[model samples]
Target chain A: MQERSEPEAARGPRRGRGRRPTAEVRADVLDAAGALLLERGMGGFTIEAVAERAGVSKTTIYKWWPSKGALALDGYFHAVESVLAFPDSDDVEADLTAQLRAFVRILTGTPAGRVIAELIGQAQTDPELSAALLERYSDPRRELAVRRMRRAQTEGQLRPDVDPEVLVDQLWGACYHRLLMPSLPLVEEFATSLVANLLRGVRA
Target chain B: MQERSEPEAARGPRRGRGRRPTAEVRADVLDAAGALLLERGMGGFTIEAVAERAGVSKTTIYKWWPSKGALALDGYFHAVESVLAFPDSDDVEADLTAQLRAFVRILTGTPAGRVIAELIGQAQTDPELSAALLERYSDPRRELAVRRMRRAQTEGQLRPDVDPEVLVDQLWGACYHRLLMPSLPLVEEFATSLVANLLRGVRA
Candidate 1:
């Protein structure tokens, strides 16, 4: 891990570098990294590559991220931060079905899907990265899913005995498998079918 | 891709001044590579490394596998070929649930899990490798799952309207997400809960 205590050299001081790049600059760096990741894939991606692509200084990147995994996580966090929003309709089944279908489409129809698969793969290799990814990305989505499932159960649309957290895990897991494995196509029709099948057993 | 007409070292004679390596010797090389992959990660693994580990010439490896991806695929195929066996029992729900739990445990509990995750990541970068992975490894399990789900539907355990392929995808996807994402605690209890939830929705 790169030690953070050292006063890193300022990168490309704009007018002698105006006050370390702001959050917007950091966001741009992450966006650049994400785009580079989709283009070059993770194998060829590096901090220098991201810095060059973002047109930011390596020191600026280092100031923001301690390691490549950290940088990737930053990008992942931004990409997936708002993806798991649960529906608000009183009809729990419709709400679950809609959210799940949207989730499936987002994963199968975008570059972020591939990026996420690669990140998950890296997590398998690096335990620290795995921990960070779960905490920064997976946990919040899971909690939101769980909360929605619980709300649905309370509305009498789902079995009260069903564990909301576990159901959410299973739903997400199924989505991951479909996206990464791709042995089964993840069309909207398939998503609707899956949500229906799952609800058949759990819906009260 | 390298032309398939002849081995890269077709001109090279058998290394033996007194003993030439045979076809069996080629299998031995792949076997050694598999062992090395199980022991060492891809970064530290190389054709030269495999040759050294196998006590064979690098020429033999190149003759068999044009790239490291091909070699890694061989290893992965060897490991997963026997890992996913669908139950043949008549009690569809019981058998499916048992198999589901077993699949979850095997995928997340072993080094193969990490290896599979890395391969998935690699696949994102290599389309040919991804196709090969799905064709040889991913599809067989899917085929078996589809077969089982279809059987259940015929037996009236599953609703006639449920699409077998879609249901299998959902189940497999969910388990896969848990394994690769490391978002959910992979435990038998969680698997059981998922099984129950899906069963409620799918059972006729």
Candidate 2:
């Protein structure tokens, strides 16, 4: 299990302060929520638990986050935001390789994989979660990669005729497939091999 | 909604001269189960309903399939079996194109997509269903495609260094991504564009 501590502000006495900054309070709540989610899955996740952990009232939590699903999405993304960032090096292949490697590492090495799988699974039934996942997480991440690919195309590193969106699908989609349907183990070298095979093509 | 009539044998009288063949009974049960699944999502699916519709005893269903998930998977596969078959034409590109097109059609045109999405979603919490899905459905389908790609490699159509498994992921994985995520519509021409972009390489 990954160890994520609640933000310092969340741990401090709530009565002594003249209302903590909104950003600090948000971070505290998310941190507490994320730690709880990582420690115990959706089954154990509750707004009451989060409020207690963060030293905030349930009303305050509810005011910002409409539902538990919404909070979970935000918390999960906040916990993983830094690690999944895309790089913009001079070389497209190198940048993609680095970014994908980071992605695979977080997915395979951390609790994020299971957390995400559960979220996606529950999203099948929960319409709000499904819409939030698309709008907040998946779509934005895809846009980042697509933007990078378009830049690569402009620089003549990637073929202009190729659709950047489909390229995004081929790369990240494969990882998600292995994650969701784990017939084959997601190997350590998968990121390298995927980038190589996709850029080079399979034609003889 | 797709109209699927119950098998004639199942619709016929149960007090026949002799016991019906196991294969025929199995077919009847699957037909009934598939129709029910397609018509109503997992929420409405029940063993009692299937047994009543198929004109078979509940004991028969339980004997063959231990859980509802197992039965649903088998029934869903049986329903979509014919359309999802991989072709072995001399041209790998044409074969992949035709097969992916069929796959996308089934996913978009029929109720199989929703059925599968629901199954996969439910599989997250259900261990037996997860195992059954991988072993019975996803793994076998991947094997079929991998086998076709290997044949293509032997014929020198696909490069020898490339991993056939990864190729499967890139193509089918992309389709699955679009189906599950739905940020972008699984467009009609996606199959063709996916194949062309992948095989030709993105490198300038």
Q: Please give, for residues A1-204, the per-residue lDDT of candidate 1 as tens digits.
A: 011222335334431344554865676677777766655656667999877666567898898687888787676556555564677998776777788888877776666676777777667667888887888678877888888878777778777877777666556666777777788677777666666767766222
The TM-scores, one per candidate, come to 0.72, 0.90
Show model 1 residue runs off by greater than 4 Å.
A1-64, A68-72, A79-84, A202-204, B1-66, B202-204
Query: B203, model 2: CA deviation in Å?
Result: 1.4
Those runs of model 2 whose alpha carbons end farther than 4 Å from true positions after fitting are A1-18, B1-18
Candidate 2 lDDT by residue in tens digits, A62-118? 889988888888888777777777787878888898888888887878777788888
Docking category of candidate 2: medium
Q: Residue B62 error for model 1, in Å?
A: 5.1
Query: What lDDT tens digits, residue by residue, belong to model 1 across residues B1-204?
Result: 122234636524443322554665665566666667666656666888777655567776777677777777776666555555777877766777788887777666655566666778678667887887787668876788888777777777777776766666556666667767776667777666666777766222
DockQ of 2: 0.77
User: Can you give the lDDT of residue A123 in candidate 2?
Assistant: 84
